[model samples]
Structures are given as C-alpha cells and as structure tokens.
Target: MKKTFLAFVVIVILLSCKQKTGIVFPAQWQNDTLQQTAKAKANIVNNLAIDNTYQFDSTAIVSGCGMVALQKISKDYRYELIIELILDSIPKYKQFSIVDFRDHIKITLNQYSKDNKLINDICTDTPVYSKDQKEPITFTAIEGLMTITNIDGKHSPFKISLTTNNLVFQNADKETFLLPKEEFKDVLVGWYAG
Candidate 1:
C-alpha cells in the first residue's frame, strides 16, 4: 500500500509539470502597453479626406526598400489607403506632384464593404503591387502634390502633406475618385527587418 501511494503521487506531479510546460507565450505578446504607446507617438495627427466625402485618420508608417509607405484605415476597417514613396536620398524639404513621379510613386485605395465582398482595389501604379500578376488596373492622378520635411534620422520626427485629385480608375467601367488629402505632422519614423 505504501508503494502504491508513492507511485500515485509521482504520477500526479508529472502530469502537473507536463501541463505547466505545454504552452509558452512570448514575452512581447504578454503585454501590449509598449506597442500602444509607440503607436500613439507615431501618429500624432492623421487627417485624410477623399472627395470631401470620406475622411479617415492616419494609421501607421512602414518603411523598406528605399521607400516609406503611409497607411490610413477607417474606424470600421472598411477603407484603407496606402501611399508609397521611393526615396533614394533623404530630402529635408521636397515637394512634388503626383504626375512628377509616375513610375516611382504608388497610391492604392482599397474598399471593403458587404456589397463588394472581394475588395475594390485600385492604384495609381502597378509595379508596387506585384511583379507576377499579368494585368492590374491602374489609375491616373491628374493633379496632386506631396511634401516631406524634417527628415533627420530613422527615429526622428517628420511631416508629410499629400493632396491628390481626379484619380481615374481604368477598368471595364471607368470611375473617378476625387481628391484624397492627408497631412501628418511631427510623426515618428522607424524601420524593421520586415
């Protein structure tokens, strides 16, 4: 009887140890306090408007491959705007219209709604989207201006003003979306290995 009781106690201890070591959560995922603080600092002010009808706040900035991309999503996650600018060198105060860099710039607007379940994906250029897709619908920016200022380093604050107009979507049924203007001031910039 003494031997049997000892064996039972040993089995219970092993089972408890196994359960405790089953799942391990990463240290970063355990708390999001740092992430929230970082996000608030990155997007100090984000005001985006399209055709004076749709308005959104700036979300985040992601950078890679000599380019910095600004993203804005609606509160409902129904609309997303991505503007990618390729920069070879840091410009303290550079201003250019959309027509100036037809190939170097990419502007994509995605709409997700119940009516259009798939997604209404449109862009000013195609190269940024994919290199394998045979055909992609491209848009034309008739008039627009973008300015970047106060770029010091990877973590320094910067400002960007983007105003676009008359984005013509080329598809079976051509549609035109009006100006999408956004201004971001004193926003922090960062880079990761992504």
Candidate 2:
C-alpha cells in the first residue's frame, strides 16, 4: 500500500511540473537596442549635407599600375574616389596618375549631401590646380547640379555620371575623357557603423 501511494505521488509530481519550451535569443538579437540603433543611423543618412570642414588631403593618396585612390572626408563620411583612366591593354606610364599630374585625382567631399533642398545627394569638390594652388579651382557636385568656379583655375566643369557608372573628366569641352570608377566601395560615415 505504501509503494502504491509512492507511485501515485510520483505520477502527480511529474504531471504538476511543466516542461520548458526553451528558445534562447542572444544579446545582439535584443529588439530594443536594435530599434534604437536603426533609428539613429536612418537620421544620419537623411541629414547628410556638405560640411565646411570637408577638404582634400594630398597625403592620403594611393596609386599603382591600375589603381588610384582619391580620398575625401567630411564630418559625415570618408570615400576613396577613383579615376581609372589607363586600361590594362596599355602599359601604365603614370602609375594611374591621370589628374593634374598627380598619382590620384584631387577631390574633397563633404560627408553630407548639399542643403539646396536636396539633402539626399552627395557634394564633391574637384580641386583643379594650375601652376599654383593657393585656392581650389572649382567646387563640383556629384550630379553636376551645382558648380562653384574659382578664379585660380580653368572653368572646365565636369560631372560624375552613375547612370552607366561612368566617371567623366571634361575641360571647357564636354566629355573629353572618361575616368572609370574602379573601386570605391569603402564609404564610411564615421558616426555610423563601419
């Protein structure tokens, strides 16, 4: 009789205890923190306009037989604008130096798009230099939408065309040459994720 009572208690205990359906989520998967971060990053992209601090650094250039890096920085982002003029078919004479007798093209970019009712676009400044570069020759935007000419350099206005992903170099005459965008995936807006 005692044995029978003990068995009954054991069954009752098993029935009373519930089995846990465990599905553990890691810390990174936490929704609250993720939502907050996403919201912040979105705002950064939206409000990205040209900053006064954006300037070209001649020291940050990287050049080789088939590669050239035009580095630009602002309070918002850092980019490597490349102009691949010489193709592989021809031997590299300038070591990818095609712009203004320099290894890489001279360009400074603001981290944000311009604030001319088009905060969604990116602003670029091409530092055109002649015999002397006391001041930048021209301030060229990405879409040719805005052009700022400097009296120090020539008035040749060029534009960046992304429709076919073509980067063109023009003087007073339009479409004089095409500088291919070889590699520019490295875009870092320091405030956001790397």
Candidate 3:
C-alpha cells in the first residue's frame, strides 16, 4: 500500500510538472493602483474646504522610480501643494523620490490671527516636477503653520503645520533635491477641519 501510494504521488507530480501557474502583474500596474488610490484620496481631500476646493496635481514619484502627486489647497486662492509617493519598496540606504519647483503662496492673515488661526495657512514645503523638467516646479517652505478659511462663509476655518523634514531624495550621497524623471512629488500633507 505504501509503495502504491508513493507511486501515485510521483505520477501526479509528474503529470502536473508541465502546468505553469504564476502571478504576473503589468508594468507600472502597482504604481497605477497607487496613483488611482491617491487620486481617490485627492478627490476627498480636494473637497475639504467648505468654501474652496483644493486643486491637486501630480509632480514626480521617484526620479525614475515610483509615483507622486501634488495637492494645492487654500483660501483666497492661496497656492500650496504637498507631495505623495508610492514605491515598490525603499532599498537599503536609498532615497525615495524628489520634486522641484519655483512657485509659492504666502499667507497673510488678518489681525485676529492666532496660533489656531495660522494652522490652516501653513503647509509643508514641497516640490513639483514634470517630464521635461529637472528642477522643482515650486520652491517653498514645508515646515510651518497655515490658516485656511472659507471664502464663501459657508465653511469654518482650520490650520496645519509640519514639524519635521519630509523630503525624499533619489539615493544616498546625492544631494537631497528634486528631480523630474520618476514620479510626482507635489501633494498636500494635511489640512484643518472646521
């Protein structure tokens, strides 16, 4: 009985040897999924303001690596963007991605501006990139307070701030700067709720 059972198992294995079973994903498919999810998140994020909806754009993911996007949200049409990334994985001792740009929106608050009031106006300094570009699309500070108010008076106000550095580079030894090759790096990290 043992011999017969072993022989049956061997025959079954041999019969199934030629059967190929594997999972193969499309090129950039994961990246595409990440982008899709990001876009969905952006849709919700864009509608955050009661009076103003933020306009989100994708900059760079990783200079020849991953995916990224930019979110611009503000009151009075004040321009601010945040960078997001979706990568296969970060290699050992490697930078994720980078975006560079030369546009910024400054915040000028009213006289009654308090710490809470300034939260909405503050945004993380982020970079923007394009296919044919090398430097950032917007150059601005990322670690500060921002106050976003409802221009339509239908929504309340809110604030946001980044207390740490959140910029990602291409790799170690390369100066932490933005590059326009891999993915978009322009995004809105967070906003206030009011």
Candidate 4:
C-alpha cells in the first residue's frame, strides 16, 4: 500500500510538469466531475474533516506531503492558493491514496480577501474519503502537525502560504516566501471524489 501510494504521488508530480498557468486535474478525474482541478480538490476533502471524537483537523496539520491542491471558492473570482495536507491519521494515513480511509486537507484562505473563498466547505455529490477498507486508520498529531513519521520515513514540512495571488513556498513559519506560481500552476494532485 505504501509503495502504491508513493507511485501515485510520483506519477502525479510527473504529470503536473506542464506549462505555467496549467491546471491539470488528476488523470483519473473526469471533466464532468470537477470543472476546476483546484476547486474540486478543495471540495473533495470534506470526508476526512473529522475523527470519531468529532474533532476537526487544521490546515497546518495537513500541509506538506501527498497530493496538495489550493482552490478558490469565494463569491468573487480572486487569484489565490496555498499548501495544506490532511491530518488525524498521522501514521497510518501518511500517503496520498483514496483507499487510505483519509481524505486531504481543507484550507481556509485567511490570507486572501473575501471575494474568492477557497471553497473549503464546498459540497460534492461523491464521497472523497474511501471506505473500501474495513478497519479505520488512526493517527496522532501535536500542535496540529503530524507527530508520526511518514512511509517515506520523514515528516512533511509546512513550507507554503496562501496569498491573494498564488501558492508560495515559505520557511517553517510561512512568514517569508517566493513565487511558485509558474511551477504550481502546472502541478496536478489528482482527484478521488467518487
């Protein structure tokens, strides 16, 4: 399962290497399902939003690693994006896989204006988190960050920050940054909304 997840991430990264401003949806995602890759990615994260204890995960916890996507979801069309990952299953659900029983992260674009929301709570007809597995995966986190090591034997660093313009890679604190716009525009994290 870990190997498969790694392969998927590699494939997603390779496929996303297109021209600047390119917004490639996951190859598995049909255009009918999600018109906008970023928008769909954000909307698809609803399932893994909570744990059995009914506690919601935070954007900081899920940032870094796996398939990451930043979408716009406000009334007005605002150019924006940020990096965030899924959490709660810090150890078991370390990779990007639908069958992992954990979905991705939902980021609230507090850094941007109110015009275009990041579609954090946007709804979808299909289920994002996979239930094909019987036993539920569990994980632990400290200060909203995953405390367990990933399958790659490392933890993802929270390096990106959301702005009114594009996804920026910053230091640990996200207080400083640079433009990953050209690179990010072509990054496709794939989709698992079914």
Give lDDT per model, in order.
0.48, 0.30, 0.29, 0.33
Name the better of 1 and 2 by TM-score: 1
Per residue, candidate 2 scores C-alpha lDDT tens digits across 90-165 of 2221232222222223332222333212112222234333342132223322221111111121222221211112
TM-score of 3: 0.17
Note the clash tally of each candidate: 0, 4, 41, 5
- Residue 48's C-alpha lDDT in candidate 3? 28
Cα-based lDDT at residue 64, candidate 4: 29
**lDDT at 87, model 1:** 55
Give one digit per residue, the lDDT tens place, for model 1 in 1-194.
99999999998887787688753335545556678867654432222122222445555332222236665555554555566766553233666666667676776655555332222222123334333323323333334566665455653233344444433222233443443455545433334332
RMSD of each candidate? 18.3, 17.9, 20.2, 24.2
Error of 1 at 115 (Å): 7.9
Better of 1 and 4 by lDDT: 1
Candidate 1 vs candidate 2, lDDT winner: 1
Rank candidates by lDDT, best first.
1, 4, 2, 3
How far in Å is the alpha carbon of 72 misplaced in model 3?
Answer: 3.7
What would the per-residue lDDT of candidate 4 be over residues 1-194, giving only the tens digit for each residue? 99999999987776676444465656636764556755545422232222112111122222122344444322442322333455444244232322233245433332333333232322244435433322212122211222222233233322233222222222234332222122122222324433
> Which segments of candidate 4 are over 4 A away from where they belong?
1-66, 78-81, 85-110, 113-194
TM-score of 1: 0.45
TM-score of each: 0.45, 0.19, 0.17, 0.17
